[model samples]
Target: MLQMPDFLTLGHVTRDLHSDGSFSLGGTVTFAALTAYHLGLAAAIVSRADQQLIPELSRYLPNIELQIQPSPQSTTFANQYREGFRTQYLHARAESLEISDVPVQWREAPIVLLGPLAQELSPDIVSLFPRRPGTILAATPQGWLRRWDADGRVWPTPWMEAERILPQIDVLILSHDDLLPFADGNRRDADAILHRWSMHVPLLVATDGRHGATLFRHGQTQRFPAYPIDEVDPTGAGDVFAAAFLTHLHKHGDPEQAIDFANCTASFSVEQPGIAGIPTTEKVLQRMNEKKNLTT
Candidate 1:
């Protein structure tokens, strides 16, 4: 019998194309599962991808268990970064994930991250996990808020199912870029939007790259600063932060410490390209202590 994983993430494993004809395996599941694993959790993934990706994924996530739903093509993205902003183009998409794709035994996983890329997961999928204490259901809703044109240029769309999904999740994590369509690039408007969602969700986090993250809970809000670092690639930092936060929160139940640990962990992710920069628990704590000593 297979033992249940401590962390489980459902999404589509993506192929991220770079300039000069290079590509790497990426997606919320890729980064999040790795973060959980590095933090010493038994992480597993339920994702859709082409069979060819299996070898590459196995190389990156050697110890993590993967339940892949075979697809004709893997979801692909080409990202252009200019002056700290990113413009993404969608090239191809894999199959969508249904609740049935999840393994029956994995439903009771203590930490669940619903990370849909390209809106390939239905909102109803949240019902798979029971809503109760000790089980954390967290989501990064960027995929649901996205819509692409015939030309493959990706843009943000309103998350119409927020009302149904917000109340069901224990935590919600999204980037400032994810709020652009609704907030019109204003931070205040973005905070207002987060405030509205916070009323339904127990914990809400909006991460601003470099500027750090803000937490909304218990009718109050707090901002946590990012660990300063020169970034090489910012591709999966938010996903890393989300996974690290969820894992730490599950173990310690302290939102502030979780955010601090998440910020440190995500800072390491950006120092290298793709998943190469994800740090071990030892490195994360070393940096955290370094930051603490510098402040003191």
Candidate 2:
């Protein structure tokens, strides 16, 4: 029997392409799996992608266990950015992940990160895991909130299953970018929607890339400011943050402490690129200590 990993991520691992034709391995599954490993968790991934790309993905992920379903083509994304405006295109998509994809032993994983990138996770996933007392079910619902045109241009859409899904999730993490379609770039509108959703999600986090993130739980809200860092690429910072926060919350059960750890960890992710940017637990602790020293 396969040993249960501490963190189990379900999603479609993607190939991120640049306009110049160079591509890198990306997706929440790729970023979150590596982040969990660096944070000292035994991580595993349930994803769908082209069989040939497995070796390449493994090269970046190293020792993490991969339970992949072979697809004719891996989900592919091309991101174009100009003057801070970003446009995304979906080149291909993998199959949806069903509850049956989870291994029996892995069902009780202490932390399960549902990070669908292309609406590839089944809605039934909310009830698939045994809700053991302290288990954490953290979801990044961008996939469910997305809509793509016939030409494959991706855009944000309302999450139709929010009522059914939010009540089941322990922690819900989303970025301002994910909520843009509904909020129409208005901060007040975003906060209004977040306030409404917070009622259902026990802990709801809305991340704003540099300004920081807000945590809403049980009818109250708290803010944590972001750490300043020279950014090389902001690619997987959100994934890193979500993984660190969920793992820390599982171990510590303190949202404030978890958010601080996540903020510090994600700051380092933007300093570099891809897996190279993920900070080790030791590095994260060291930075945290340094911050404490400056204040005292």
Every model: Cα RMSD to truth: 1.3, 1.1
Give me the overall lDDT of model 1. Answer: 0.92
The parts of candidate 2 lying over 4 Å away from their true place are none
Q: For model 2, where is the 10-residue window of minimal lDDT? A: 125-134
For candidate 1, the TM-score is: 0.97
Q: Per-residue alpha-carbon lDDT of model 2 for 1-296, expressed as tens digits?
A: 79999999999999999778878889998899999999999999998888888768778679899888788999999977889888899999988887888898888899999999989987898788745687998899888988899999998889988878888888999897677679888888888888888999889988888988999986688999988889898998999999999989999999999999999999999999786889999999999999989889
lDDT of each: 0.92, 0.89
For residue 62, give model 2's deviation from the true position in Å: 0.7
Question: Best-fitting candidate, measured by TM-score?
Answer: 2
Q: Each model's TM-score?
A: 0.97, 0.97
Q: What is the clash count for each candidate, in the order shown?
A: 0, 0
